[model samples]
Target: MSTGKVVLGTVAGLAVGGILGILFAPEKGSVTRQQILDKGNDYADDLKSKYNGIAETLKEKFQAVKNDAENIAQSGKAKFDEVKNEINRPAANY
Candidate 1:
């Protein structure tokens, strides 16, 4: 699977395990709730960080591809111009 999906699955598993563990702990209800809240925020932040990293990678890859395409187009145009100039030139005297 893709890296994004793997990261998302891992984060989700961690969040579920954390909440379950907290629920089974001997802490008071108020403390348990607080822990869950904190864990949720932490997981959210981690997910956001992973998402941003993936987005940046995709953007960089797209830019590289775009640059390659532009270079190829320019090269093609240059070749076409060279051929056109050759065709339009006068034949050399034998």
Candidate 2:
């Protein structure tokens, strides 16, 4: 699934679990709230790290493809120039 869908699912699951815990627990409201906040922060950090890694990989792939296209264009131009020069050369007299 896409990153957005994964993130949404994670958030939804966390919310549901937190609600269940608060409903069933004998702990104070403040303590449960703090726990949920801490867990959510950790999950956010994990997702951020994953996103950065994916972005870096995509950038490298893009650069490689761009370089290959440039090289191909240069090769084509060189061949065209060589053919043009050959055609423009003086013809031999009989």
**RMSD in order of candidates:** 2.2, 3.2
What's the alpha carbon RMSD for model 2? 3.2
Alpha-carbon runs more than 4 Å astray in model 1: 91-94
lDDT of 2 by residue, 1-94 (tens): 8977987788778767876876678878898787778777877787789789889999999999999999999999999999887777644321
The 0-to-1 C-alpha lDDT of every candidate, in the order given, reads 0.91, 0.82
Clashes of 1: 0
Error of 2 at 69 (Å): 0.8
Q: For candidate 2, what is the TM-score?
A: 0.71
Candidate 1: clashing pairs of residues: none
Global CA lDDT computed for model 1: 0.91
